[model samples]
Target: MESKKKIMSEKLPITEVNPINSRYYDYAHFTYPWHFHSQYEIIWVKESTGLCFAGDCIERFGPGTLIL
Candidate 1:
């Protein structure tokens, strides 16, 4: 049998409410590099318009966009 290791992010944020937490980020520009975490993330683009780079896919997202 073989096992695979998922890519971990060095920029993993420190959640005050570990196990579950949420917050809004307003940035003048996309500041995060392509990264992944051990947990799932639900992101809602409230403002600004730009492209999203996920694993093996590229997408355009804007206000009211929801990502899971």
Candidate 2:
């Protein structure tokens, strides 16, 4: 059997007036698949606990956890 890996390319909703894209999510769990973006990204978790996977690194994150 052949295994296939897929990653999604995400485009940020940025504009001239607002060059930065920010969001606040309150969900039971993350539903997005593996993805990548051209622009720099930052994730700040205000509340929740989960495992964060970046590249080949995996770490546990919770409230006040910031990733850049």
Candidate 3:
């Protein structure tokens, strides 16, 4: 079997959290598909709203919530 590789992003500073992560999607929303990774994630939304899916739970989140 051939080896497959997953794309990885560089470490970002604390000030550039939202825009850096939000760039995953474009105006049409036909960006990268749903996927999971081994690393644990924590997202912070500043002046924005969107949907979140973690494991089996799905819901809308905003600027003050923390997801695991």
Candidate 4:
């Protein structure tokens, strides 16, 4: 959110890099704490799985999943 800020790295395969909106890149994993923002968010997960927390919605997600 807030203009889509992404923290990126390259320790792993680029495809492994979680996507955030129109901007795309090849990088590593990312993490975000429980929080909120004003902008819209788009996320894609590939080759990985984890729990997602969005505005009190808590659930487990797997690869090839998209969240917004």
Candidate 5:
């Protein structure tokens, strides 16, 4: 499947304002759309509970959860 290039926000918390575009999210659920990027992306679930879908794999994620 061909992935899409998402253009994240540039205003601080919306997206990484700095050069190395890595940002933090503090919310209740995983609501971001299922998309992909050329740059490596990492997700660290600090709180709450939800499911993560990657390709054909589906896993439950919660506090202390990290995905790359």
Candidate 6:
């Protein structure tokens, strides 16, 4: 129930000077909680293995996985 009530609204660091905001994350594990953003998100897994949750859809993802 916390995930349903505590959905975070993320404000991406995008500016007029830089339209697109890109970042590379190399972490031991995913620490971010359930969240949503106004802007579209594209996640590319270069090397990793985990589950991806989008709405009610849940699936396993591995290296070279691209989620749009």
Instruction: Give the alpha carbon lDDT tens digit for every residue of 6-52 in model 5.
Output: 74433333335544666567656666655655455577878888778
- What is the C-alpha local distance difference test score of candidate 4? 0.63
Report the C-alpha lDDT of model 6 over 1-68, residue by residue, as the tens digit. Answer: 35445889999988888779988888888887889987878989888898999767899999999987
* RMSD, one per candidate, in order: 7.3, 2.1, 7.8, 11.3, 6.9, 2.7
TM-score of 3: 0.46
Q: Residue-wise lDDT of candidate 1 within 1-68, one digit each (tens)?
A: 89875555754565767667667777888776556866677888888888887767789999899877
What CA RMSD would candidate 2 show? 2.1
Q: Residue 53 of model 5: what lDDT?
A: 78
- What's model 3's overall lDDT? 0.58
Number of the candidate with higher TM-score, 3 or 5: 5
Q: Is candidate 1 or candidate 2 better by TM-score?
A: 2
Candidate 6 structure, TM-score to reference: 0.77
Q: Which window of ten consecutive residues has the lowest lDDT sum in model 1?
A: 5-14
lDDT of 4 by residue, 1-68 (tens): 46875643323222336534355655565544345655567788876777787666888888888888
Residues 1-68 of candidate 2 have per-residue lDDT tens digits of 99887999888887789899877777778877899877877888888899999767899999999987
User: What are the clashing pairs of model 4?
Assistant: none
Model 6: ten consecutive residues of lowest lDDT = 1-10
Q: How many clashes in each candidate?
A: 0, 0, 0, 0, 0, 0
Off by over 4 Å in 3: 1-32
As for lDDT, the candidate ahead, 1 or 2, is 2
Candidate 6 vs. truth: CA RMSD?
2.7
Question: Against the hidden reference, what TM-scores do the models get?
Answer: 0.65, 0.74, 0.46, 0.53, 0.60, 0.77
- Colliding pairs, model 6: none
Better of 2 and 5 by lDDT: 2
What residue pairs are clashing in model 5? Answer: none
